[model samples]
Target: MSGYPDNPSGHMSGSARTRRADAQRNRERILQAARELVHEPGELKLHTVAKACGIGQGTLYRHFPTREDLLAEVYRREVEDLVAAAPRLLETHPPLDALAAWFDRVAAYARVKRDIFAAVEAATWQDLAAHSLGPIGAAVELLLAAGRSAGGVRADAEARDVIILISWLSRLDDTELDARGPRLLSILVNGLRAHHRD
Candidate 1:
């Protein structure tokens, strides 16, 4: 027999596992860099993203073949994170506080999305919005359900209505959002309260 160790099972060897880990690290670095740079003032170029992440262009291209691909992944990951926060927040905080915190997350997401949508093609933006709507709405519903059960939120508060109420966040400029986001969010949250006066 050859000097190499025999492997009957299909599990990845140590070297293969290391390579996979390295690839995942590189991908995450790229995404993190892209997320930051996308908010900057100029056009987001692939080379700039690769450089910011300390990865070579070829490596970046291997992970994301086009700028649209990278942008789409970033947007999708943002939505995933936003959706995943609902359950975790509910587990840790009171229903009303969790709902308030989730709204904060939504405001952050809207900022990033507004910048990203400006960079991507209209078709890409449309596709991303279509795919994200259901999961995001569901996340809102989850938070609202918890609040309603706790008697902190109105039983009649619908996810779509909440969505519509917050949609204007995307239209605010960065300065305006910074100055007004918290107050606006507080108003929105209080409006959903079970005991709020008309």
Candidate 2:
């Protein structure tokens, strides 16, 4: 609660309160429509997306300002999802398996990106590449640390290295599917294990 806002939401002038509520509703709808399409990154039609969100196309534009802006937001949220899932996986699975499962989730997510999020621009991908790293890196570091403490993960595995490896793994096609992920994660997990220590 340290940084919690005094409002715990947002300040609104009388004239803006109704508009703010409408905006919040539209934003929620947009986020819902955008969530499943986060990874695909292609075929995210704003007009159709608006319909899916139960809002008008104009409202979508009004809220998002532009397509690129919407895409950026959706990208940020997707990264958040991946990061958020880490703790849930750790809570439910054994350490190494949790790590492996998370890898599998991410690898599959790459396929989703191509269909929903649209063509990846060098600039956009660059932005995504840069911003997406921090949360995931932290999550992986935590997972590896947990695994290590549990005596299942290798000691020498660094979070930065893990992030790099996962970045490479994320570009794989659906044909590669779960095959490469589990195997690669196994080796990585072995490297993270205190016993292997390499």
Candidate 3:
């Protein structure tokens, strides 16, 4: 018998496994570096990202293929993280608390989106719209429904309103946002709360 066992699927080889692990690590490093740098001044440069990740331009290009691809992937990951947090938050907190906490996360997501739009000015409305608000809308709907059922929120509150309110954060400066975000968010949460039962 040969030193290596018969592996038809090809991934069972030790060298293949090592390469896969290395690729995953490199991919993570590239993404982390991009996240750190994309928010800074000026446009994003692939070389800078590669240098920060300690990887060659060839490797970065191999993984992302294009700058738009990289930006889209990053944006998708951000939305996915936000959408995934909804269920976890609901499980851990009461309905109203969960809704309030989700708004905080939405603010953070808006910040990330602002940086992304700044860095990739040509990322097109269609490119953005392709991400589809379905997941986030569903998350907000779940929270709103829970809040209403628990008698914590107004019966007329809509999920789209929460999204629109949180989106306003994208228009504020970092300094002003830091100063006013809490109060503004408090107003928003209070507005959503039930003042009188119908």
* Least accurate 10 contiguous residues by lDDT in model 1: 1-10
Better candidate number, 1 or 2, judged by lDDT: 1
Error of 3 at 198 (Å): 10
Pick by lDDT: 1 or 3, better one: 1
Give a tens-digit lDDT track for model 3, residues 129-169.
Answer: 55547788889999999999999999999989987888788
lDDT of each: 0.93, 0.72, 0.83
Better of 2 and 3 by lDDT: 3
In model 3, the Cα lDDT at residue 3 comes to 63
lDDT comparing candidate 2 with the true structure: 0.72
lDDT of 2 by residue, 19-115 (tens): 7787888897797776554544345567867877777888888878766677777667667888888999999999888888887777655555443
True lDDT of residue 191, candidate 1: 93
